[model samples]
Structures are given as structure tokens and as C-alpha cells.
Target: MPYDLPDDLAKLSLLDIAEAVAARRLPPVDQWHPGEVIDSKMRISADGTWYHEGSPIRRSAMIRAFSSLLMHDAADSRYYLVTPQCRQHIDVEDAPFLAVQMEHKDSALAFRLNTDEFVIAGPENPLRAEGDPDCPAIYLAVRHGCEARLNRSTWLELAHWALDRSDDLSVTSMGAHFSLQPK
Candidate 1:
């Protein structure tokens, strides 16, 4: 079901947003009409730190709340904190979130995000790496165009699980083969 948000998102508190998400009342963010332009002071750094006006946002709850509203607008090639009635753009240096942990579950790999969301590595949510095995920018598609950059430890774990194929470093998840890197 669609959410009934305040006409002005600025008036909505973090708690409100969190509650809406927790209740699974998110509307299709891509379909939301943009209201008055609101410039966000927030920026997600390469290491998954959320900063507001150059200062790190230290509250974990606030970070999780904001993450619930994150959406990648393919049309604009930008990310936004989307609400039912209002939206605001945000900057993402690498990815909006981080995959901090991983679990090898039977035939699939389940990634746990910093937000505590679990994403199974499969055809719908693929794992990828940009660069060599030693120093790679690893990412896992968390949901709906939102990718989580795998933390260093998670990346290392993925590397250990990857199979060295004839011409690529690959892994099998849910019977689907994913290429990690060209050998």
C-alpha cells in the first residue's frame, strides 16, 4: 500500500520515515512527483559515512531512517531521499550503504548490510567488483537500483569464495554464475 506522507517532507521527522518504511508503506519512488526543490546537506561518503554539512551524522538510527528513503532515479541518474509527496537529492560517493557481513547459505551467499538488510547474491541481486582482487571496489545490489559497497572484510571473504575459472574469477549463487573479475 502507498504511504500517506506529509505534504512537506521537511516537516516529517526521521521517526515518521522509519515507521513508514517499517510498515512497508513505500510508494513507487520513481513514480513520485517532485515537489518544491529541497537541497540536502547530506552526503554519503565512499566509506558509507553519512555526512551533513561536512560533519559526520553519528546517529545510527538516523542513518537507517534516511537509508529507507533512498532511491536511484534512472531517468535523472541521481539518488534521492524520496517521500510520497516530497523528494530531495543526495550525493553518493560510492554507494548509499555498505555490505558489512556475509553468510554462505547452502548454495547462495547472503549479504548483510549495515542497515541490517539481507540480500541474497543471485540473478536478481548480483555481486560485482571493479578492479583487481587485491584492491577492488566491490558492490552488491541490495534492492531496486540501490547497491551496497562491500566492506573490506566482506570483499576479502567473497574473494576467498570465488572460483578461479579459465578466464574469470567467478562464483555460483542460486545456480547462476557471476563473474567477479577477468583472469
Candidate 2:
């Protein structure tokens, strides 16, 4: 899906953004309890490109549909595309989604995923930094035990935004404080 980002995302109120997020309806993949699990022969590359068998899945609508059915099973440490009928395992190179864009407004940060989904960083969906301290990889909890890695540009944008907020390299959203420092 084509997403038209705001000319000035910072100008938008957090309430408006929250309302928009709430308005979106996603499938309940978590509630699906398929007895049979099978290989999907699909992979999501480190760059967030979806591939089936050996070829890339170019359809945005199809990717979007498949993504909505995505779930991470903690028991197996695996990702799957689930439905009421069956569960199909898929490989994720790094993360299921890539955070391509970010917006800071009202002390809250909103991220736009490669799949054109919006996620607000807060208590329910938190941000985490890992890997090297000098160039820490940042990620945001998406849903159903899945995460979205912040892309290079989005990370830089968030870093700049954080620098403007505090010297401690921390930011607060919905009364929860998040450290940008790598752990």
C-alpha cells in the first residue's frame, strides 16, 4: 500500500496519531490455533523484502495481507503465517519488519514500518537498542511477539530527535521512559 506521510509529522497531535492507529483493524493471528504447522518456503530478508521460494514477492497488497497473518511463536522461536486452518513457518533474516520512517510529536515517537503500518512507542509497544554501542541497532515491538528494526535513516532521525530531548539519551512516551543507549 502507498502511504502518504505528512509534510510535517511533528505538527500533528499525538491524540490524532493514536486515534489513527486505533482505527486500523488487524487480523487476530494470535487467536488462531492451527494443529498442523508446515514450511511456507518464504523468507523475509534482512532488508525487509519478502520472498517466496527463490523469488521476491512484489505485490504490496499481498505482502500486507500476509504480514497481518504473521505471528512469532516463543515455544519454537520461529515466525509463521497463521490462519484458522493451518500455520506456515517462514524465515526472518533479522526482523519481520523494518522501520522506514519516524515521527516525534508530544514527546511520543511514532514509527512507520516497511509494510506501511504505524506503531507508537509506549508501554504496550516499547523500543529497545542492542548490538554495538557505537552503532546500536534499534527495534520497536510491533505485535504478536514480533519486532521492527529501525532502518539506518530512521535510526539517525531518532538519534537526532533524542539528542534534542535529553543528554541522558532517553525519551518518554505515555509515561514510560526509553533509553536509546545500547545494551
Candidate 3:
């Protein structure tokens, strides 16, 4: 069977793409090994806003769809959107996606990402805090090595919840311990 590559990626709805990804129907982008490079005027800001040509990418669905294509190149330590035939670089100011909402799951804190994926914090996917001690930033591992920054408000909520745990500033989720401070 021929691999189904959409004719127009921008025209596809985010929900449809998310569903396909959830079903494991897409190819492993990391294995594509395409050498083509396309320069895009796209950048993802610190707050998870996508910008094109210095203007915000207003469509939520478009952002979600593009997020699905995001990949990190370990060889060069850069981020790209990789398709089977081509690869394009995108500037990520902080993280690709934002953890907009969170849920209390059984022994875990499930985060609902901006791209509509729910990730449960665990040993495989640990949370880390970086940056200044006064303003530490929270990040959640998404897939591969890509991470999503928890928005300021969401971080605050997590901090509040962490306070109840202990003074060392760690939380246990799904039988794994994650530190609020960088290790």
C-alpha cells in the first residue's frame, strides 16, 4: 500500500491529524532521513504562539497541525518539521507546545497540551525546571526529546500542588519522581 501523504497539509483539520497520530498511522519522521532543506519564515515564540513573517499564525487548527510535524534533529541539535520528502527548520524560542490544562489522574498528573495530546508525567516522561531560580520554568517531555513548556499559570498551579509533597520540591506521578528543580 502506498503511504498516504496529504495533498494540502494546511487544509487538513487538527483533529483529523491528531486522530491519525493517535492511531499510529503516520510514518516515523525520525527515520525519513530526507536531506532537503526549506527555509520557513516560521517561529514558535516563548509562549507557544506560531509566527509567520513576523505575524502570528492565528488559526488554532493550523498551529496544531504544524505541531504534529515538529521534530528535533539530534545530529545538529535543531528543530524541524520533517516530511517524507522534505525538512524545514523552525525557530523555537523556548518549547514547541504549551501545557494549557492539567488533570489529576490516578497517581499521575495528566497534562493536556496545546496540540491536543494528553501526556501523563512518569519515569519515561519526566518534568524538569530550568532557568533562573527566581523564575524557574517547567517543561514536560513530549515525544522523542521534544518538550512542552508549561505556561506560567500552569506552572504556578503545579508549584502549588508540589508544595504539599515536600521541601525537596519533587512530585510522584505514576510511580516516578520528578523534580521541580533541575537535577
Q: lDDT scores for all predictions?
A: 0.73, 0.88, 0.76
Best by TM-score: 2
Sorted by lDDT, highest first, which candidate order results? 2, 3, 1
Error of 3 at 74 (Å): 2.2
Candidate 3 local accuracy as lDDT? Answer: 0.76
Tens digits of lDDT, candidate 1, 114-134: 775556777888877787666
lDDT of 2 by residue, 57-118 (tens): 99887888899999999998999999999999999999999999888777688888888777
Positional deviation of 139 in candidate 2, in angstroms? 0.5
How close to the true structure is residue 112 of candidate 3, measured as C-alpha lDDT? 71
Residue 180 Cα positional deviation in candidate 1, in Å, after optimal superposition: 1.1
Highest lDDT model number: 2
Which residue pairs collide, candidate 3? none
The global Cα lDDT (0 to 1) of model 1 is: 0.73
- Tens-place lDDT per residue, model 3, 148-177, is 999878788888888876887778887988
List the candidates' TM-scores in order.
0.78, 0.92, 0.82
Model 2 ranges off by over 4 Å: 1-12
